[model samples]
Target: MRKLIAISSGILLLALSLAWWMNSRQPQPVELMPILTGQPEYCVTCHSDLPEISASHPVETFGCVSCHGGERLALDADLAHSTMRGGANPSDLSVAEISCGGSSCHTGSEADDRDHIQRVMTSVQSTYAGAIANIRYTFGAQTDLTAHQGINAITDERTQTGITALEIFNPTLESNPMIQKFGEECFTCHINAVPREGESYTRQTGCAACHSTEQHQLTTAISYTQCNTCHNRGNYDLRTMTFVERTDHLTNRLEEYYQPIAQFTQCEYTLDCVDCHTRSEVMGDGDLHSNQKDIQYVQCKTCHGTLTELPLTKTLTDPNDIAFRMAFLKPVVDLKLGDTILVTEQGEPLWNTRVLPDGTYEMIGKATKQKFNFRPVMGTACEQKPNEQESHFCHECHAVER
Candidate 1:
């Protein structure tokens, strides 16, 4: 009886050990499902509006998940549905080599954030045009405008590079290579929403912010009409008018073709891809107007800040007060740094600091005269609601609104 009992106890212990081992060795599957509903679609629905990015390749119909890895159908805001984190993962781009730039899109060893956006846009467009031709002509005939433009009998024929309606496409023209505006770059003319000094927060704006376009008055967003933002009316003739009178920079010999100056010259200064050509000459071959033979042409401001464009502002000499009230007249202004402003006869102030949130200001003392009025040394003023008496709150007169 004792032997039988010992045998039974040993068998029971062995069974328990086997069960524990099996449980420990079992593998658990990782949860890669998305946490949010209508995820990839939600992002795609809006991103598709960007024609250069959405009109071609798998992205035309495929959702964000196709390029930017993530659960396309996620319903929650969890890590499982995350697309890119700490630069580890990014969208599966079509041309992986083109992802060298700084941006949230692709984080690679070769990526550069400085102008990644422009490079990406240009690459995507070039790739798409090539792909479309492959499908339509099967063997890359003169199907697209690029080919026609490239093969034009007159090397100086005009073509499109996207921004303005101007057909300033001339192969013979030299370009400012550093001013990547002619190619797929965005910031060459675009601006991001960022915070401003004295102002809590401000939306991103373009040249149109300060420069008003009679054509775009009804529109809320900035437009090219605001060209004087940089090229003021006074300097317009100097930049545009002067270019036309000079000998063709492409062909050293005087040419008959008129170089189109479509933009307001000041704000719309960057050249599109066609502006920088590999096979064109402007002025006679060996003159200052000729293109660089071996080196790529770049804007002086790009690598060298020799021609720094400082923001211009109107003088605000407070005859009564000693401090000067300088105001920047750009599209977006910041008051976070704190400034002193004087109320103008118009509802607008003489020196508009940065735009305030909620379309209102923290009026401390009387709007007119005070020790500390929320104003900046430099800024511009815009049209405001007109009233019989200027609007003022007691708090703005007494309390320091920072």
Candidate 2:
């Protein structure tokens, strides 16, 4: 009995020694106390391999806990992620206010152009008001083409279009079969909606839907491919109230850029969408618009002047001009004080464009970073009518065939 007890004690001693040696070989936990939060966090111990989120958001200052809520001191994987906001996507609208909101952040004064969250929430893309209005009117659910409902209920006290509020549109409650089918089958293209299951429709929700790439990094240099995920991947079949994916393979960039029925100019297919569309046009102007037409006002004449006058030019005199701020965010072009750039009819500056010393306008592509020199239609031998200056009229003469 004494010999057996001695052997058992030796075995237990060897096991304890082996356990201590294995633990010593492992890497130690790394703790970080961010300047913004001033709270100690152990997230880096597990996520040390992740790249910095962006130049605007530094890991050293923000740390992981500030943006991604979790057990800052937890070492176990499940415990650390148990309270995380939005799981893998913290910028989701459902929790974006908690994750990315403040007066200095995305939700702030509209005069400073910092009210991103409010603008996006009321944008036509989020509301889906236009499609709902059209379908409801066509199916006799409503009397006119005016929008009376949105995907979600929203209110805007300062709406310029007199559409102060919209009741939540529950298509399931409608009596029309077509309206009910629209609710069941045709409601996935909105910014908050989960994209259809496919590689072409791959995208995140809310702000990350447009700002984040597959590398888990945020960027402002968005490409046409990213927009294609939601816009050009497929078309909805109104007859059947279903979505039909594009099946025809294209042979060239122009063919791939737009649908076969589209008539676009060379620059339309060449430049990315962000190059032409202003921030207010795409992100909403803090107003509750009924349809896209009410929001989008950029025309061919916005960049290229009419035959009588050059495009509207505004010289950058203030150091705190919004154009400088926009250029700093994208960084594709260098804009300086006294440099004259084109402005939209609504007075939004085209920060990526500049008037050269030779009197020609030079535009830097927002995504491709390519330089393009263009002359206003005033000097060219173009016969565009003054009143008929819409882009579709220009396409009648300059549109490239698919």
Candidate 3:
């Protein structure tokens, strides 16, 4: 009987060991999409209100795996969100300085770092005004113009050509006193913040916000021609079409009085503002304007000219296809260091230029095609100041006296 008891005990021990081995050999469960990065999943639980706005937090939409570049699963939020360390927290403090903007993907320009941070903070903290006019104007004015699509547009195709009608001149006016007068729900786009759901007819649209513009006063479908209706175009002392010049001296020396097309009856002349004015921003394919001293060197010969030649002058055209008579108006072109343009004299073409576009090319005198494909000629004629030779015109660069 003792011998039988010992055998039975040995059999029981063997069976228990086999069961434990089978359990240990089973496969572990697998996960599909892991939350492997910063506390994005945590941050989005609160900030998913507007995913479309680019200026707003964009990483939250990319999911956790795109940024974290590590293991997905963690036992708790502390382990999931904490930076990985080999052992205990290391002596290196560099990990503490890591930020959303500090990432290689979002580094703003050196000059714009502080401003970008302030703008981001303002977006996070302040309540937006729910005014429709303010909303439209803000989007219309502040949307990224480099994308070649204005805020008001649904699609943008002209980005490559560098031309678009959508203009967002100044973006920070939301902080102005006029914006504050309407109270918390000042702009409808910011309704996410205030959550007011009433359909009252009294709420003003895009008019009130634009009417308050101190410069480039926008009207609801207001024709560019009627600008002089409330403005004194010539005196330059009083308001010109709702734009009050801030300084005593005008920056654009080449600016003649702007004549809006809507007011013209039998005039047979219409000019787009771009034909005279340079875009404040620089670009590669399109014409640009400069506010500094007018010089032939900085004019239309900048971009169109090949490396070996200068550009020839061509007749200027208005938006309406009317050929501007040389006697009536001069064509202006921007000239940079390397461009190509046509230089013409008395209905004859002369040289093509090698510089890119920078300053305006306004017709000052009539010179027939004399020199064929001349390199930047010296001692050109002068319109305003004559004593200076015109090889590298514009005192901003050459510094020669007129």
Superior candidate under lDDT, 1 versus 2: 2
Better of 2 and 3 by lDDT: 2
Give lDDT per model, in order: 0.27, 0.88, 0.28
Where is the poorest 10-residue window by lDDT in model 2? 248-257
Runs off by more than 4 Å, candidate 2: 1-27
Span of ten consecutive residues with least summed lDDT in model 3:
282-291
- Tens digits of per-residue lDDT, candidate 1, 273-340, equal 11211111111111111112212232212111111221222233444331121122121233333444
Q: Candidate 3's residue-wise lDDT over 104-197, tens digit each?
A: 3323442322222222221211112112233334445334313222222222233333332323212344464332333332223221122123
Candidate 3 Cα lDDT to native = 0.28
Q: Decide which is better by lDDT, 1 or 3.
A: 3
Q: Which stretches of candidate 1 lie above 4 Å from their native place?
A: 1-52, 58-61, 78-81, 85-272, 275-402
Going through the candidates in the order shown, the clash numbers are 70, 0, 57
lDDT top scorer: 2
- For candidate 3, the per-residue lDDT at 188 reads 31
TM-score of each model, in listed order: 0.19, 0.95, 0.21
Ranking by TM-score: 2, 3, 1
Better of 1 and 2 by TM-score: 2
